[model samples]
Target chain A: MTPLVVGTSAIKRATTPELVFAVVRDALIAHAHDRTTVPPPLHLQFPDADGDCHVKAGWVTDTPGFAVKIATGFYRNPAAGLPTNHGLVCAVSARTGEINAILDDQGLLTAWRTAAAGALATHAMARPGAATLAVFGTGEQARLQVEWLARLRPIDTVLVHGRSKDKTRSLCEAFDALGHHARPALADEAAAADMIITTTPAPTPVLQARHVRAGAHVTGIGTDMPHKNELPPALFARAALIATDDHRQCLDHGDFGHAVRAGVTTDTSDTPVGLLLERPVERPDGAITVADLTGVGALDAALAAAVLRELAS
Target chain B: MTPLVVGTSAIKRATTPELVFAVVRDALIAHAHDRTTVPPPLHLQFPDADGDCHVKAGWVTDTPGFAVKIATGFYRNPAAGLPTNHGLVCAVSARTGEINAILDDQGLLTAWRTAAAGALATHAMARPGAATLAVFGTGEQARLQVEWLARLRPIDTVLVHGRSKDKTRSLCEAFDALGHHARPALADEAAAADMIITTTPAPTPVLQARHVRAGAHVTGIGTDMPHKNELPPALFARAALIATDDHRQCLDHGDFGHAVRAGVTTDTSDTPVGLLLERPVERPDGAITVADLTGVGALDAALAAAVLRELAS
Candidate 1:
């Protein structure tokens, strides 16, 4: 049988922020409960093209279908009038080994699911009624994180920090256009916000420990690869509570892992983001919290399945 | 751009045995010469459905495109009136990471590539003017091996060995229908043939060293996974020369690795099949030869690119 081919526009039309948040939330909880199977991703680097590709597959126990996704990034693509990312997800039947659908999302689902995960983690780990949000980097993810977070809670202020002043101004304008108070801020100034989210692909620390204030929650979203880091190890030493999406994956490639490798923290001090979603953790007065997210395949599978269900309906 | 979707019938019409042979031959040589990049496959197992899936990707240097392939096998599918294998190949542009086409061949490319590798290895390693061929296993691979090898050289007699008498008879008749003299024979009798090919997914060895003659060539195609072994270590001890498709992959999961683990042979003693294809090896008098094939992803990428090129033209 020919599998249903769902293109990017159709996928976008069929999915909503609420749908993605619910689906990704359930997936994270399922993963924490050990009810999902996600193999280590297959990564391929093309040095000549300044590009790389990642293939990730995951299956939730008792689900009707599984998903195999391919996401690629070519750093020079934007210079050629193309997006830096491209990919598709294949959803297959669990019983018959037949492909059920091909979600040619062009990495849209990846971005949305990642945003939902980050937003969920940030809301779950941060103190109640947190209003000010400081965002690092000025990419699509940075914007998505803010917009998705707005769907969950109220943010009174958004401080945008980026390497390029024009891009930073543009991102702040975008946030302002979305009916939020946004302005460009320096790294040290942004670090003093109520909640912080780092979304840069910088190789070195974008925010140091001393720059951050007490009672702030920082979520690291850009350090999925080994060489890319956004937070300094000294910051983890100050965080009273730390959370990770997946224990093994985050400990191996996440910002949390880098902190452990640097001897600032032990691996056992972190909690699963799923567990935090299930039961909110108690926060100590004047203590900081951090969440290290490397992204999980199970979340992608769940989100793809949810979108396919919506389309089929 | 919407990627072209090429289904099974179109893929078959656009490809020929000759085309596959040439494509796979060049890919093997490129892999041996370090001109190809093939990442280790991503494997997923679903115990509830008794199924597994393998995701492999590859790229040849200076090539126009690369391929990411998914092949699934559900052992229970045949009982439900479905084929045991299903899959598709995604061809992506190397320069921009844009998907060029999706060749939904339903695992046909994988089978054809495996057959081509086996046939090429057998023809190149077998003694000059060898006439008799014995095939172990009564699957599609066994039949394809015979047909593909016939394209490379002549076989005066065909000996078939199978556990099922009915399958064994049917296979022999199939070979006879193709105008090759064929009959059923025992393992010992079949091992004495000039060339032997084992295609069964047996946990234990199917042929022993004592059964094999002094001057014979054996190509193993079933031991791609760790638990599914076809050839015995004793057979490797009898083999004067050993050839592997990819040295690192073969040493990790191929039958050759099993033999090395059993203390039968060292890793360095084996030769790359591509090197042997470029410059045929000199055979010692009364010495046996064996080829261990775990299959290579580079071959899949090359074949998919070739078939896509054919379809486009």
Candidate 2:
């Protein structure tokens, strides 16, 4: 049998970001429901003059279509001015174990899957009239957040805040072309927005506790590694709900890790985003809601599997 | 940069079984001399239907230009007519993390490596002018053992024993074509040969203590799993020197496992094959010698790395 060869360009042309977002959302939900135990991924840390570590995470599910992999290369910082996070997603045939696709769009799948996590969280926790959206970080993920959030909520205005004003303004203009009232805003403007999405890799807190409004939903997908932080621990102290993709990973690397270390949140009962994504749960009325997404291997596998199915069909 | 792709046909055409056997022999010698803390390989078992299981063993080493994988799949006899043992060797590039070559030659690599282990043991343990050879099993590994033994030692006669007379005759013909005096013989004929090699996947002992010649050298490579046995425990009691690729693996799975269980051998201080292969060691003169080779992932990785280097040049 001929091996499947799907590239990033083909994946982009075949499916829209919105459709991929939706498929990824559903896949994450299905995986959340699956109770099968998977082996912990093998971790490989390379020994070099400069400390550059690569974590190879693998998950094989008995899904009928394919065996999907979400391999992310995290080079803390290379001397060559390359992005710290850059890698590819591979989908392989289950029967023959042939790699069918290489979606090397430089973390495009990562951004989409992360954005889907936010959408899934919104579907489970956010209020019905979440019209005002605030996104921190004017990079590719910031653009993806706007595209994916618009699919789940009827947003009339989006507040864009970044370290660079010119980049944020350009992002706002792109959002404006999508028929939304998007504008560069101060940090206070983010607090007033109904839903706040942070995608910056700031080493320090970018979102303050005092700026956030009551009943505001906050989704942080930036602080995936231990050293990165976008939200302060005090922010989750009064939040009604704090959810995360994987509680263990969050406690080790996400904003929840800082919160747990600071003695703000101790229990892990409702922290797992998978549990919240699968069912409609009651969010504390008029209380701040937070969802910390560190990303998971299963989510990547799911999205790759979904993309493969759509392309084959 | 374009990725390197070396398929089974390329490997078959570029390197002969004899050359591969010699390459492995030299690798074993090099590895024995290299001082490094080598750990036993990790095994992953998959539970299947009918109370059977599939095993996957992984070996990783930090040796330069050596990061290959040896994955074997074994299944119990079922209604399907698939071979009980089959798998592939994936040779990966250390610099780029790309799989450079795949050898799917019906486990030919395994047979060649095993034969090389036997040859290494013969060089270390056999006395001068030891010529007569006896092989148990008419499989691919049996053929490899005959050819490799002929290349290493001055062997003019070879006795072949197997359950199938037709297969034994055919294998004898192939060996005879290689300019050796070869013929089909009974299991008792092996007793007269100066050197013996066992390659069958028999669940019970195929070579008893009485069938081995005095002062002869024996190498068994088939009983790598706990449930498989090719040589009786009595043989272990008689051998003055017995070595293995990995002492821990042999104690857990190879012929040593059964011997230890039956109280035939109490100590394993001198069992690691590396000690014998690296330097001249003290052993009883004209005593029976044995080497158990369950295969090692580091060796596979090293051989794959060598092959990749050769291909690149």
- Best by the TM-score measure: 1
Provide C-alpha RMSD values for all models, in order.
1.5, 6.5
lDDT of 2 at A11: 66
Model 1 interface RMSD, one decimal: 0.9
Best by lDDT: 1
Query: What fraction of the true interface does each of the listed models get right, in terms of native contacts kept?
Result: 0.51, 0.00
TM-score of the first chain alone, every candidate: 0.98, 0.84
Worst lDDT 10-window in candidate 2 chain A? A49-58
For each candidate in turn, the TM-score is 0.97, 0.67
| Residue B77 miss distance in model 1 (angstroms) | 0.8
The sequence of per-residue lDDT tens digits that candidate 2 reaches over residues A67-147 is 223233434344545455544554543333334555544566667777777777765677777788899999877888778
Which ranges of candidate 2 are over 4 A from the true structure?
A1-4, A13-30, A33-37, A49-62, A65-150, A154-273, A285-311, B16-139, B154-276, B285-301
Please tell me the TM-score of chain A for candidate 2. Answer: 0.84
> Over the stretch A130-169, how does candidate 1's per-residue lDDT look in tens digits?
8999999999999999999999999999999999999999
lDDT of 1 by residue, B136-182 (tens): 99999999999999999999999999999999999999999999999
